[model samples]
Target: MADKVMVDNQAIKKRRSFREWKEDTARRLDIWSRKKPARRKFWLNKTLYLMMIPYLALFFLFTVLPVLMSFFLSFTYFNLLEAPKFIGWSNYLTLLLDDPIFIIAVQNTLIIAIITGPLGYLISFILAWLINELPDKLRAFVTLIFYAPSISGGAITIWSLIFSSDIYGYANAFLIKWGFIREPILWLQTEKYILPIVIIVQLWMSLGVNFLTLIAGLKGVDRSQYEAAAVDGVKNRWQELWYITLPNMRPQLLFSAVLQISSSLGVGAVTTTLAGFPSINYAGHTIVNHLQDYGGQRFEMGYASAIATILFVSAIVLNKLIRKIIGKVGS
Candidate 1:
């Protein structure tokens, strides 16, 4: 504890263990005896800077530029027929105060996100962990089975068959056979059932890139750390995971978190595919759906921009909050 440590966020770093303490002490003690490597000035690293130009240029041109334009346009009313007219928060005002469907959209979006985000995250991690421990051939086969639904172009076709609004639908057939109901229920059409069914489908389709990332993270974890942790009084797998595994996999966890949250919040295409766009009195309406409806269907670009801005801000805030929480993982 003699060495002073400075932190913009102290909770980000867990308390050091005995090995870490010893290593730090040894490094400090041997500092003067070791010859230090020479550091290069900024201009000397021009080659590395040049290597990053393509990616940086593409990111700014596509992502940054679009976001900036959307933010600027959110305050104006443009219907694509004429010049954009500045309304100075009128769109936002209408969104907050005047639009009832917007409120419903927000409510449904939160409901979907709240149910799916953490559930999907946990499910993916657990499944990935199990998969990572399997033998190579079996793992490859199993990985394809789990991952196929996410990448396959015919995913909607598969789901539609299962939940089709007819006597022949798999779910309805199963239920009717068991005498659960007399007739086939309109699983996708009903207001009360549509959102829940969508959530179930979302969870079923949750094993995508996030699942792969966790598997890679689990594989990348240093086995030596686990061995050292066990010798240092780690009692079980749970303890090792809490102290050693998670801390080492922090970067993967952060990346997966962003994907999971984005997937959960941006529930547009799947909702439209499974349930209709504005399904049964706005029961399945989400912010993304609302934005598309206004922007694409109504040609109200300003209102659409405002909706997009709200979503953008919400995602940013949620991401920051999650980053802070995830920073405290090992602590």
Candidate 2:
């Protein structure tokens, strides 16, 4: 009976201790919440905070939350029907070492991005520069012509018709008329021609936002700066372009680079539409297509999320690199 009473007393003391710790923690947290600088600032600018809520909510819902969820999902094994099970790097290992089609997709994606990305930027800038030289009305007309291919949703269909395997196809007819080859070439079907044709179509589509940005940037350049450059013995058009124009257009150039990198890396819709999804031995297959295959067709959301995370990281790295290069344009 004495031992039992002692045990009860100890139990009461232990419970009281726990209760005291809980109260202390709550008090500290309350004090910290009141003293927090961010909380104070938020309340100070209540109207601005209120105004930002909608944008913040949308951004979190669409961009930040999806990315975070995707990153988390990358390490898991998830088929849509089942719960995600943590797999611990197996997906990445398989992607890197075991998957031949993924290897092909990566190679194809890199090839397309390397060739089309810089080339598209150069061509867009050049076209914009030339158009900038024209009278305002003519410049607008020419811009429309170049930009039309990009905005036109059915442009790929037109390209398909032109590159059709039939002898009646425009490209085949032209080639045969010129005696370049006796047979009609299967532009999309043949692996040899697939990448080149896709690149061509991609370049055509590439002139959308970046091209417009270049035009705007060029227009925004002060005419007096060119006059000043001329006075400073900037003897040639090349010098003027290299030293004056490009430096002034850094913001637009940066914007265009980011746009081009993302578009080039994420080139699934066009390739799939033009060449078909798998694309004949995966010749025209890209990382984006691989992601689509896993996510959309196989319902392998985990692997798809891994691919997305990779793409996101690559874009960030490439953007930083391009910014560094662009930073040194004139200097």
Candidate 3:
């Protein structure tokens, strides 16, 4: 009977050991099952991350680093020949209180932006809409015509001849024949006419990438939606546009608005080219011109950086405001 008890105890111990092994196995399998999806997802996205590295690197190197450096430099007083000296808010204070030319630049920049930005955007959309109604071939031709002036680099020189101060200039001769004025007007030289001429040139050049984007957006809109609207008793084209077209093209509209704002506010190159760098009494001088004056001419790197930071902040704020306004368009 003692021998039988010993055998029975051994069997009991064996059973307990088996049960423990089974439970441990199950726990390990449960843990692996939970972790498998995350492992698979990491491997799946690994290729995408690798592909993105180059673009991210270039963006940081060129765009992000420069902006950061410029922001840091804004707080210092640095000339090109010397190291930066820390001066807190002095540049900004001087700009706001003492610099009358900076104020003029701000005013001119705003006037140009307010007029050309909205007007040019509206005109581009209208032209695109009208062209979209034509036959495909004709639409293509018209689009080329409207977009030509923008791409034709240095074509603005022709306007110089047209508005020349010479008595024999086209504008002067025409006006003289019509008895509008006694003599040739200094379109670029005189302060009174300078702003108007620059505005005209800017408007002429404004139908650019935004116009093309609008045309593409108009083309991409689904025809079936329009047909369904007609079935639903949508009365006219105007009603359809308000409800369907505008909502469908919201992305393109937002993109165009951003491009327009940037282009409009950064209107230095054209202004400098048309009206001289300083212009007459800085009549056409913009914020960009003032930036060039300090950064390029005077070598006051810190002041230039401060000006750049201000413009950058202004652009960001304006973009946000525009985005908010545009967000209400389709709703």
On TM-score, the candidate that comes out on top is: 1
Model 2 alpha-carbon miss at residue 118, Å: 0.9
Lowest lDDT 10-residue stretch of candidate 2: 38-47
Give the per-residue lDDT digits (tens) of candidate 1, residues 177-280.
99999989998898898888888888888899899998889989998988888799999878887898889889999999999989899988778888887788
Which rank order by lDDT, best down to worst? 2, 3, 1
Task: Say which candidate scores most in lDDT.
Answer: 2
lDDT of 3 by residue, 9-64 (tens): 98998898899889988676656556789755655576798999999999999999
TM-score of 2: 0.84
Candidate 1 at 105: error in angstroms?
A: 0.5
Write model 2 residue lDDT over 1-331, tens digit each, in one string: 9999999999999999999999998677666657888876655676898899999999999999988988989999999888999998988898888999988998999999999999998999899998999999988999999999977788888888888889988999999999999999988899998999899999989889999999999999999999999999999999999999999999999999999999999888888888988899899999999999999999999999988888889999999999899999998
Off by over 4 Å in 2: 1-51
On lDDT, the stronger of 2 and 3 is 2
TM-score of each: 0.86, 0.84, 0.85
Q: Candidate 3: deviation at residue 83, Å?
A: 2.8
